[model samples]
Target: MRISGPTDRRGVTAPAAGRWSAGRARPRVLFLATSYPVYEGAAEGVFVARLAESLIPFVRVLVLAPCPPAAAKRSPRARGRKRVRVVCLRYAPARLRLLAQGPGGIPASLARRPWLWVLVPALLWAMFVGARRALRGACLLHAHWAVCGAVGGLAARLRGRPVVTTLRGEDVNRAARSFVHRLVLRACVALSSRVVVVSEALAQRVRRLVQAADPIVIPNGVGPEFFELDPPSRGDHFEVLFIGSLIPRKRPDLLVEALRTVPGARLTLLGDGPERPHLESMARAEGLSRRVRFMGQVAPERVLEYLSSAEAVVVSSEREGRPNALLEAMAAGRAVVVSDFDGAAEVVEDGVSGLMFPRGDADALAARLRSLQEDPAMVRRLGQAARARMRSLGLRWEDTAARYARLYEELLSEHGGAAGEDGMERGGRNGAA
Candidate 1:
């Protein structure tokens, strides 16, 4: 299929003209993911949505994601421009569908409620069916997490199409702990035509699991909205922002504890999860209820507003694969205090672009906050430097989309198909498998 330069009515600029000839049909790519936004302006899996949108100029995208029971009624099969369509697969009954709706995703949900494992068969079956149907017009499959990788890999294999699996942080982290997860991850790595990791640290983790696997490192990108935001002003109090799920892995509790020592500093948590109650209780116990505000699950579009209001943003995750929040905060010109996780150093230079504290060390994080609180000038310097670093690195969604497009073209060619054409040989039934 040929790439078109037709601009939609929304005034979005199309890709450069004459990039691809108009004789062939555009290659269709199926994106398989466990987490995706149920509606427009949603914060859940918004990075996935952003990436899908960015690819509109390069390839046709079909996103297949699981629909949480609560969201099934409102979730639309199509979103945004016509070039990208999102199909949400319904796996379990309304009351019983609790697997992919929680803080840490399926693993966290399973950990919280052990009985939910019974739904695994239904979920996998639904994904298999949905992917099988979606792959009919698809040139290749791009699976986001390990779970999607497993399901999409199988579907692609059966359909005789190529697969590209992207390993984000949680999947690799899970593989590092469980043998079963490792086996699944190994299968995903082996079955895929190409493997993509969000960070070098994650690539290393994958290498440890399967020595023969060589994964490409493609970091997620920040949207232009973040970079367009005006520099934040110093508020009356030192406002520290934390923008992530209130999950244990994110260490929101540590942020709360760190706020205890920074006397006048106020902490604003912009997301919610199963750990909310625990973090709220911790704040109350530490007598920090007045200073800490839990703003539950802000929209992706509004994140820049909060970032623009804060002097500094803190990422206290114990592990990460290049957090979007960290990148967005930097792009919004906010001083960042990130934990020294494996991949964090690649994103921030300690005391240069941003500050780094020991992971899970409440005291060290508190000290970092205190230093920022005392020196407003330092915050400005760091924030400006962070923004400069992001610009220098070209961490825009367009840049990331271009890289994926190149990878897609490379894979299609290697698979004995030509891009910008009806590449894949059709051999499947029109209906779901």
Candidate 2:
């Protein structure tokens, strides 16, 4: 990693061909994301990093994201190993960075530390400045969330560039709950050249927020890395896996409650969040401190290992755009039980590739878990079917990245044509080309 500009303090060197050029106008894209993997192999928003990596071969991608204050001590190698360049802007003080708005998403972070609200202006200003600096001679901008989209859209508008925004789960479900957030998000959607959502359910929500909003449905793709590893054989004890932030929406507490009904069943949670202590206390109260294991946060590769070892994977999120956990588990040949909310039904077919239960229903969830435990053959069959379904869907990261590349090309063509028309308008009297 080498420094390039004043604002470009951190960067990851890409492939020989993907490096920045000062003489030629290569098709470049600026990505605005608030949540990204901070540490090496950190589990936070690894999908964002994966998508950025996948897009590197197609275009010169530069990511402008917020770095958690506490991550000032991050190892040099923790940035990433890909063609995409990332510059993390620190908005909070060093000691307070851990409480800043980055990790468990803006909603959860704000909930954890309300005083951080004072830093919102600084955070947005930092992103604005970073986006302005990164957008020099860039053809397109793609923001990962509504907030980022709003900020990045302003920067792109200033540069007269086309901007696209992807409304992943929380941007619509959590942030959109607030009146001010809805207003800002609607403005962002209005400014976006294209609005992309991971699921049709989210597209519908976007339409409600902005009546004229017509969002394209682009599901998140599973990477080939997850498919390369084979799952370990199931054991005698019924073991299930839950891999996501332990937030209220994730409903890990309900998963623990369901385990109480299933007697000897074990649940291993593989991510950390603000809700961990409360969830642990709930599990202890139910006398399940022994069966429920909180693995905290693990490396991205270890997630696949845990998925490979488990008999089934459960996604108990009350609201989601598209959970990588569900998709990765499906791709890894493991039976999945997802909550019947948000986009769960879009990816899962009940009694087919996986099972879907009503959210917050511990009894229903326990019944489904017990059924799989009683019939190991059904578990294996479901898992096999899930793997096949994922393959048939053709949800590969390479393909997903190519689709965005096509979109970027279209935007660049539009921009070029617009510029040409404006030039002719300015010098039509002189017959200028």
Candidate 3:
């Protein structure tokens, strides 16, 4: 139950003592994502790509993720998997457009349509039949979410490799209300010798949900080099942007309603989900569609471009485990207007770096929005404060990798070379499609 170090006092540094042999003899580490850098996606791929960059110099890496099943049965775009060879799994159906735009990927969406359970089992079986061997050579297995960790933990146990699981947003934040999901996640957390969560709130939540589930709280990081302060350019409209999935929890409708009080100002949304069509309908109903533009979904590379060109990025999520989108937005020097979720409040200070409103209160949200929009000087001051706040936090990609690497080493020490946690790696027996 111990992790490597806090690293704040030590500063970000590589492991100089544990040097590996030269040439092709690097310590091999296997990174697992139920879905990897699917060429297109959200936080999962973003975190994976960043982790890959951090771990490459330290270990020989192989990123294992889901690829399309058979081309004929998959979408033409899903065939994009032909590009990478180091990946180890592919169970995505022919119907998926891509990983991000995939119709049934998100947890809330998956919870609504139970039939997709078929895909989970099919994926587990495929990973078993396909991945058991490669894992034997792997130093450790690191999964992005509990489900992905369930798959990886089970596989790693079968192959006798150390396994680590990360408690991502929906997986840990919303676990309390979902009985079946909590059971499965508990099993994964129990089996995982080490579990990592982004926020202290989420870490405590996981501890309450699972037995012996002592999770390490490592707040997500933004590459300092990438998201520096790029002060707003002149002639830019007082634009406020909301970038997240169009789901109920995100509360984008609140953004639409907030527009009622902020006259002549423009609001932009940059994602798609179950609520998109309804949200669009609501926007037109309010006549604010004239001021709001739904960008549907945009590429990750283009995300910073959008943030760079805006005034502030607003967050309206009902719940969060430290959103990757907001950090990126803040790192880009844009002020934030987040919903009054505890997680959001944890990061933003009122009238300081950013502002927050009571959950679902459109009026309060609009007032905050209007305040930032009308006063350019206030916006500039807040943006500068936000940038300075983040810069002082001691977060970077190298810190994140070192934290996970240390936790893995600690988990190995506690669990020993014998058998590991039980239920998580037992997925094969858990019924199939």
TM-score for all models, in order of appearance: 0.91, 0.88, 0.83
Number of clashes in every candidate structure?
A: 7, 1, 5
- Using lDDT as the measure, the top candidate is 1
The list of candidate 2 runs beyond 4 A from truth reads 1-25, 77-82, 99-103, 417-433
What is candidate 1's lDDT per residue for 33-145, written digit by digit as tens? 88887665456788888888877667767788877765755645344344357777788767787888456788778878999999899999999899987787788899999
Best by TM-score: 1
- What lDDT does model 1 reach? 0.82
Residue range 1-433, candidate 2, lDDT tens digits: 1112122112222222333344323355678888777556566677877787776554556667777654567652233244456677777676666533344777788888798788788888988888877777456789988888898899889878789898887778754578887877887887789989988899988888778899998778897877765754657668899998877888888898899888768889998888899989988899999989999888887887787679989988888888888888999889999889876777889999999999999899999999998888889889888889888877777666666766665766677632222211121121110
Worst 10 residues of 3 by lDDT: 424-433
Tell me which of candidates 2 and 3 scores higher on lDDT. Answer: 2
Error of 3 at 387 (Å): 1.1
lDDT of 3 by residue, 1-433 (tens): 2223234455654432332333222345567665444454333355666766565434445666665433234322221112222453656645641332242254644655656666666766765655566676555677778876776778787777777787777777557888877877987886676788888778778878885788888877787644564787635467888887787888888888888788867888888777888888888998877788998777666777777778878888788888878777777788788887756756778888888888889999889878887788888888887777777765577777777666665555555622334211221121110
